[model samples]
Target: MDRIEQFAPPAGTAGTTTDVGGVIERMRGFRSHWPPGDGVAVFNEVYLTVTETLGRHLSDGAFRDREAVSTLDVRFAERYLAAVDTAVSGGLPPECWRPLFQYRLHPGVRPLQFALAGINAHIGHDLALAVVDTCRTLGCAPVDLEEEFERVGDLLVMLEEQIREDLMPGPDLLQVADPLTHLAGAWSLERARDASWSAARMLWRLRGAPPLAEEFRSRMDAGAGLVGRFLLTPCR
Candidate 1:
């Protein structure tokens, strides 16, 4: 099968599940489906590692509010899974997700580019919205979830550093003059996490104003997609 076919959801796993374990299961399914070098697989592998880490923390009672954190984690994962389903079903994913899906199989894009582009889309767009979704589901406010958000963000940050270390081209090949170096330098996960928190707060405030919330979401999606496009610039 082609890469896209490999990404297709197995017979009964297309719908989003309500638990972190379920989300991790779906991601693992994707990992097994795609080739090691497949762009989506690259991102899936990174995400899977972070999610597994979060799950361990949850089991170990690491969070102050386990239920809230669990809800947020599951909800957060659902957004990305939904995007994958959209692409698999031949529908348009959110603008922020478009670039990675569109360029998934590009020969010119490195695995690092694919991984970062997917991270950009997920954090830049999905994260803020996930916060809103989690709040709505739990009948809580954004402020209430601040600690949980930070904990999750910290896990992601740790995994991101590992991803860079593992995927980056060696010093002999990745020079200051390389476009990959420039692209990698241009985006910061820490910055993205801060922006996502701000956006989540803004979105929460706009919730009562549906039209405004949608407009803000649309703009954020578009802006993120633009960045993803830039990150995926064929560096080969």
Candidate 2:
């Protein structure tokens, strides 16, 4: 199957809506469908919390360019929403998301790992596409959206730290030699953030070249998925 075949939306809702609220609503619906502690639900709860925070920040004039921020946020969110709708309807998620969906309930994986893995896929793959989508919607260059992108990225970084604290395993599991600790240390949201910024720039550069752009995006998606699979490695 194609790399993105994993992210196909359900046949009925496939790209049927561009409304941001609709996307969040769908996520909420999905959240309700599963138990709170379920792997997918755990990540969804963290994500929904962050998304709501962003919406509040946007409402209070936290952004320099409200229109641009709003556009980027919506576009960024739609990609994830599409993935959920697809998965719920029985479609495959994207390569970057396969590992999470496959191992969402693994007994060996902790909630913190699930959160990080989900963030890895979303920020690593979804954020870049969101940037391109925003640029297209705003009729501007990627440079024009840099400030907003950094702002969103900064928010995400902070939220990630907060999530770590909230989802951290108990003191016993925090041992220096614990596999979970090693796994947690193995990935860095900061590094992922930097890489995503570079990927966005690179993708924007190739926007005019369809073949090259597709190739780059596919590589990015696959690479991110590979990282996600690693993050989900059972560590019991």
Model 1: residues >4 Å from true position, as ranges?
Answer: 1-6
Give the alpha carbon lDDT tens digit for every residue of 95-189 in model 1: 99999988888999999999999999999999999999999999999999998888888888888899999999999988889999999989999
Deviation (Å) of 50 in candidate 1: 0.5
Candidate 2 — worst ten consecutive residues by lDDT sum? 3-12
Q: lDDT by residue for model 2 over 1-236, one digit each (tens)?
A: 55334333333443534555655666676665666666777888888888888888988999999899888878887877767665655778788888888887789888888998899999899988888888888899889988888888889889888998899877965878877788788888888878888888899999889899999989999998999888888878
lDDT of each: 0.91, 0.81
TM-score of each: 0.97, 0.90
Among residues 3 or more apart in sequence or in different chains, the pairs in candidate 2 whose N, CA or C atoms overlap within 3 Å are 6-92, 6-93, 6-94, 7-93, 7-94, 9-86, 10-86
TM-score of 1: 0.97
Report the CA-based lDDT of candidate 1 relative to the real structure. 0.91
Candidate 1: Cα lDDT at 91: 83
